[model samples]
Target: MTTRVRDERGSAAIEAAIGLPAFVLFVGMIIAGGRLAIAHQSVQAAAADAARAASISRDARTADATARREAEASLANQQIDCRSTRVSVSTAAFRVPVGQAADVTVTVSCRLDLSDLSVPGIPGSRVVRATMSSPIDTWRERAARGFRIPDAYADVWGQS
Candidate 1:
């Protein structure tokens, strides 16, 4: 009877040891998935802000600068897992010099700011990116009304 009781206790201990790890693994995955979803939304918002900034500018250079600032600012304000961001604008006008009627393509990228979250079991630092485009012709007109764009677009001044 003493030997049987000892064996039962050992079996229970072994089962607990195994079960604990599996339970922890499941919970960690759920948390990581939630973090990923938040990061994705932040990236999408940054991208949309960048595109809006670009569309309000008259030329590719101005659009790029405005979009970049907007993307960075958006990410900063959101304060999500997005630690770094870059934005760029490419013109679809197929012209040597981007002009008022140019269609601008905006791209925004963001990545996890956590350093050395180096554990493989946790969320791998992720990069989320998005792109959008809009025409600048209407923006040029709006500017004529003395309506200045936001501060992020300040770099685009006088470049129609």
Candidate 2:
């Protein structure tokens, strides 16, 4: 009985050793996932804000241009490096309503690659992207707003 219990004691230690690294890895993945989720949400908010700004104010691309700046602000609040943020916008020529605006699409993407920044032990970074569609102040249609895309424009579904 003593020999058997002693053998089981070593087995528990061995099991612990084997499980520790895996448990740590799982926890790390969870943390990484959460951080990436936050980044994605920030991008999405920035895109929405930019698109709304563009549509309501007829700012067009200028509105989309604010996405990065606003997103950076959000990341700053989160204490995350947002210097790698990229933002874009696509607007449909079709108006939202007779007296309203057209619709603009805004997209934000970011990759937190700390290799260039030289953070230690973090291994790899993450990439997050978000897109939003906003109404623009065009003179087309509110009730019968036809989806008039520009020659150089494509929706997210169209992008390969």
Candidate 3:
């Protein structure tokens, strides 16, 4: 009587075929996670920059525009390709009287594209948001409210 030997031919090929896809999927997931983390950090930085920029402005209108522009510039500098971006500036602090404590807040939202990763179960895009606030200088001169006497006419108008 002869013992039968099991034929192991093609077993390696089958194992490779099964393992390769799983390996690819794992790598894809890692790449996707890393991308998201970096994007979040970048967005946070953008929000900080925006808040600081807005806080330095003398008026609410200028703060709004400056915050948006600074956020966009920060994202661009970081090479983040956002499909859509929204920058919201809360300048309510601008209403605060001079010589008082106030702060400017900025929120930045960026929609990042993940379709290129082609990772299964991952959304085609994700929105990352960050909010930051910066204190305005307590002694900084802010825009005057209501009617103001012109510098040239201040003497005649008695400095309203």
lDDT of 3: 0.90
lDDT per model vs. reference = 0.67, 0.61, 0.90
For model 1, the run of ten residues with the poorest summed lDDT? 138-147
| Residue 55 in candidate 3, Cα distance off native in Å | 0.8
The segments of candidate 1 whose C-alpha lies over 4 angstroms from its true place after superposition are: 1-10, 81-83, 93-102, 113-124, 135-160
TM-score of model 3 vs. true structure: 0.84
Per-residue CA lDDT of model 1 for 1-160, tens digit only, reads 3554444658878998999999987886677677667777877888888887877775556666888888888877887645566666675542423254656677777767434232354434667788877666633443322445567777787533
Error of 2 at 123 (Å): 2.7
How should the candidates be ordered by lDDT, best one leading?
A: 3, 1, 2
lDDT of 2 by residue, 32-97 (tens): 667667666766776677666655543334454564456556656656566477777665433333
Off by over 4 Å in 2: 1-7, 61-68, 91-101, 114-120, 137-160
Candidate 3's C-alpha runs over 4 A off are 1-3, 116-123, 147-160
**lDDT (10s digit) by residue, model 3, range 1-160:** 9999999999999999999999998988889888789999999999999999999999999999999999999999999989999999999998887789999999999998887334655667889999999999998878846736569989997884
Q: Which residue pairs in model 3 clash with each other?
A: none
